[model samples]
Target: EPEVTQTPSHQVTQMGQEVILRCVPISNHLYFYWYRQILGQKVEFLVSFYNNEISEKSEIFDDQFSVERPDGSNFTLKIRSTKLEDSAMYFCASTRALGLASAQYFGPGTRLTVL
Candidate 1:
């Protein structure tokens, strides 16, 4: 079975630095999304991308955050000027379609740590 994979399983950075999290969604999926869980909090949607453009985004995805497809197989999330609150497990998910019946496949997540 195909699955989403993230790079650098764990990332540590300074509070003012920038970080780029990478993901490779299932080869056949069409829709992609970015979500984050801040420690013990619930999973929060950040943004969704389809057809190479942002389909939707949550308030949490402020100017400091950006998403890009970059190429045919890669999806990425970039966080500028990282903050302490930015430390979380960022997840990448993909689905073939959007609907209640479509299941989203999630990646293991990339743990980001800010100091």
Candidate 2:
């Protein structure tokens, strides 16, 4: 079965460094999103992308963060300046349908650790 794959399940980085987390979303899926969960916090939406543009973004998606669809299958999230608070599990998700009918499928997650 097709599934989203995220690379480097865990990463440790120094503060203020740029980091790129990669994910390959399910084939034929149209909508994509990035969410993060702190060790004890609820999952928070960072951004959602469709049609090569951002559909919706949360306050957490600040200038230091960006996302891109480098190709037909690969989606990536880049943090230009990492902070200690950036440590969390970043999940990549996708859905074939839209609106309330669509169910998002998530990856295991890339655990970003900033020190």
TM-score attained by model 2: 0.97
CA lDDT of each prediction against the hidden true structure:
0.95, 0.96
Give the per-residue lDDT of model 2 (tens digit) for 49-107: 99899999999999999999989999999999999999999999999986678989999
Off by over 4 Å in 2: none
Q: Residues 1-115, candidate 1: write the lDDT tens digits.
A: 8999999799999999999999999998999999999998999999999999999999999999999999999999999899999999999999996555789999999999999
Cα-based RMSD of the predictions, in order? 0.9, 0.7
TM-score of each: 0.97, 0.97
Model 1 Cα shift for residue 79 (angstroms): 0.5
How many residue pairs clash in each candidate at the backbone level? 0, 0
Deviation in Å, model 2, residue 95 alpha carbon: 0.4
